[model samples]
Target: MWRRRAPLATACAAGEASLFVNGIDPGYSGDTAVYGALSLVTRADSILVQEVCDYGNYDDFDFTGTSMGFGLTRDDEPPPLFLPGVIISMFGGLVRNIAGHVGVELDEMRQRIEPWYTDERIECAMATIEPGQLAAVRFAAVGVCGGVPVITVEHVTRLTAAAAPHWPYPPDGHIGVHRVVVEGEPRVEVNTHVSHPVFDPTDAGCISTAARAVNTIDWVCRAPSGLFAVADIPPTELIRGVMW
Candidate 1:
């Protein structure tokens, strides 16, 4: 368990650092490996989890076959094969051939733009995924304009029921599920978005936010349905209260 936890921890930490330094959310990159590893260990099968980044807006997660390793993004522009060879060819044909081979490897590595997720696809994924693995299937988007990270985890059963007649929101936005207590029994709540205060970048604040996010996800994933209970105040607010 500790070994399993280490990869995710490293990945999350790296992602947080990338967010602060590059203003790019690489969480999905790290998350891909974590999700893949989790699927393999839990199901004893190889699985490929790919993240499609819309660059500064939102990101979507979906599973693929093991053949699709570290799937490509739309932004990955391919290098010019013949053009580069032409330049080197002026120097020598041998050099040009070498360059072409290198170009081939580069092209192989670059992934094609991943397609956007649809409501039907997400619903299907949710239905097929093991309850315990739901957490890894979650999607998150950091608002580049606002720098706020909105994390979304789904409960398929709840979401399907919620969309009894029709789901109102766009498919992309329907990534979250909520928890509520009704008649002394726990139930899935729909159409609720949980917002937490943006973590302050101060050393202490970052540490606190990371810890709480980990703890919260762990608790939520273990629940019967994959959702977190709403808090009156953001968890960061609570941390501030205690720290201050």
Candidate 2:
């Protein structure tokens, strides 16, 4: 993809700039936030970042019920997002970005998929999920080194809390969260929660996503031109105000 955008890099080299940002999954869920907790990294055998979200209050039917395949039954065709290699296609950059910073040359990429079905009807905020429908899923995109997994991005998402009772839960037992775990280094963990007084987790996520993009504009414009990771850019002052 970057190969096709060679001109963007060239423009950046000529003093123009470009910035790529995303929401919770490839955004705070892994790349930048995952790198922030490396100070305690005595030894990192494996680094895992997770997003555990309960979409019960998220009212976007197109996203939750459709895009994520939350209301589909076992017999229904899998959503395009859940098709083979789709996880890697979506999150491989996140794995590669972290690997590039950790100085690990990944040998291959792999994905783990576990789609859970709802045993009973679910009255979700976005749509109704009948029994046997795909109500939750836990999927991971892993980057390997020497045939061992080194960096991974996982998501355990459900339309409602009752869908995947056996799967991984949020660190704070909340409706939404992003958790990062470094297994070998003191077992350090970082959990980020974004919530609003008036909005649901879905809307909160959307707001924070745009906030990330807006806040990074200055850094991106000042940095050198090229495709880069969060670590590649120079540090700047960060402000958190109530302006939002």
Candidate 1 lDDT over residue span 1-244, tens digit each:
2574466557655654211110001221122222323333322111122222111111122322111111222343322311223222222222122223223111111111112222332233223322222111122211111232112111121222222233223234533322211111222121222234563222232343354444344333333422122222233432333432
- Per-candidate TM vs. native? 0.20, 0.88
Index of the highest-TM-score prediction: 2
**Candidate 2 residue-wise lDDT, 1-244, digit = tens:** 5774687778766865665555567776686678777767788888988888897777877865686788787788888778889999888888887888788899999999888888899996777888888888888999999889999998888877888898877765678888888887578888988888997767888898877666666666666566655555544522233257
Best by lDDT: 2
Model 1, residue 221: displacement in angstroms?
32
